[model samples]
Target: EEWMALRIGPVVNLPINHLAELSSKLDPDFPVVAVCNSAYRSSLAVGILQRQGFQNVASLAGGSQAWIDAGLPVYGTETQATVSAAPQRHVHLAERISAADLSRLMQDLPGTFDLVDIRPPQAFAEYALPGSRNAEIADLLSNPGYLTGAGPLVIVDRDGSLAMMIAGILSQKTQRPIKALQGGLD
Candidate 1:
């Protein structure tokens, strides 16, 4: 079934909410295997699918690592699959920046860039970079109006991961450049 292939349901980009929507469209009776670079995301995907009533959802244990280790033939294609579900424009910053870089950015505070705090409202109210706007990462989709107007956007979270997540979503929705604070507020 190499070319015929196991009809994998949805290979979500990075957003967890998209996984939930994809799960709803899947054939519940058919087996679905969630895969990612590693098992972490796939496991999370499985959990999401399960909660959404996907009974036969399974995560590829050990993910692509186990498949490569087992000598399973991997498919490679230059052509990208166009997922209508994917947001039109989004920049993903997978690498973390340094504290020094963050300090310099803050000191300079680029005029065209808007600093957004992606942490919880409580955390942001307690302490955050001065003048940073609050927008919880989890509520980005629910509140589409969070980011308004046009400008480069910077997201600050308690940690780099949450910032990255919010950055991806904002990048998609706003079609604007989104950056994450290198070390967050730490």
Candidate 2:
């Protein structure tokens, strides 16, 4: 019963300017509210935009948690997950491709992709896909080596969701197109 209280706005992200742009669509002088899974990411968003000379951008104090804590209404649309309206600074993320397509890419397009397995090495070793190279998402983000190569960088995980989420981050981090394997190994 209490869970139905999530009536809020569409999930939006930023490099500040995009947030401003999205805000401008509403009203050029409208203030931008940046919030993340929590306050930290939102703080970074607001800070970056301000530093970049964007004015009137404010990070939602305490973010969604704060709103929820205050017992505000949340128009939770559980079906709408993942953000599509992000700036160019964000990694362009794709939903997913089938396991069959993945197999084809491996066999047909050799050297075209990296077939990055974002799971831990231990899980990867247990039952890795045909030609996947274990590049844990965290490590890949830090190393930058994983950012190399051409073609579509397909990210894999045990399920589709984690890979999808990581794909967004990886794409943003590398400024390249990265995809998640749909439905993972399941």
Candidate 3:
């Protein structure tokens, strides 16, 4: 891919959701190569960054998979992480818990599960479930152990898609049960 072949030295791992908070920290004129497992999301990120006044941002044409396929180097194993093919995995019923079931589970099993609200703090503050705790996706990615030994860690988000993907990524990192809210709280 033309984009991947450019060989940027450092990679800044940014989730699409955290763009607003971190955008101020990024130099708008600096060259940036946004990447994902597939290029679709990264391509969209290019537009978002551009709209936010980023001047030289571009998306990897085929994303990290293509970069890996072409034998390009990936850096910072400790902080920068990637899911090989998370979405393609077969999702089991237990991987997503319904809101109703989650309610009952909390009632019946009390502290058997940890509810993690991945939405932004303002949204979470406005309306979040009784026991859910607010967290950014970056935090969970940086510390997979946070999801460890917490009964089943239940990730809650606005739509659940991001939550589900995060659950998939964290599941690969830890043996703990990671779940997303089914259909989310929408």
Candidate 4:
């Protein structure tokens, strides 16, 4: 009950700009500790503060996970806090495709389209759509050499999720028309 009863000061949960504002109010030599759920966000906060010329800002090493793991109490309400939304980087791809449509696409492959398997290397080696070439999704972002410039590029994965992710990356990387094989290798 004492663990639950213990109350701590409110966490300085604010956007980067607010943190900068707070830093401006404090003496340049004063120390400040940034805390977050897993220290990841706090590490980001530390970077932001340091860039703003706050010379004494530090991130709490273990963060809130360490506090909870140590059996210490959490003082605040579980209600939502104000957080600035970050811009999303990944592209949104189409959802699932039908089995009938997949079969129709397969019959027309190798001539009208280029089948690029976007699954992991190990998975591709085990089993893949016949005549499909391996092009790991990660590699597509870094090395685009394996991709052909000839036909429409169709990305195939074990499931649609990986294919969609690769399609998004490919869309940004090349001028080639990209499409994901719906339902993947299934």
lDDT of each: 0.68, 0.71, 0.81, 0.68
For model 3, residues 82-163, the per-residue Cα lDDT tens digits are: 6665465544333988988899988999888788999999999899998889999999778756656869989999999999
- Provide TM-scores for the models: 0.45, 0.50, 0.51, 0.43
- lDDT (Cα, tens digit) per residue for candidate 4, span 110-179: 4676677877788888997766788755676677663557766777787677887777766776666677
Clashing pairs in 1: none
Candidate 2: stretches off by over 4 Å: 1-91
Clashing pairs in 4: none
Q: Which model, 1 or 3, shows the larger lDDT?
A: 3
lDDT-based ranking = 3, 2, 4, 1
User: What CA RMSD would you report for each candidate?
Assistant: 14.3, 13.2, 17.3, 11.0
Best by lDDT: 3
Better of 1 and 2 by lDDT: 2
Residue 123 shift from truth in candidate 3, angstroms: 0.4
Over the stretch 93-186, how does candidate 2's per-residue lDDT look in tens digits?
Answer: 5658798888887888887887878787889889887777887666866777767666777888888888888777767766556788999876
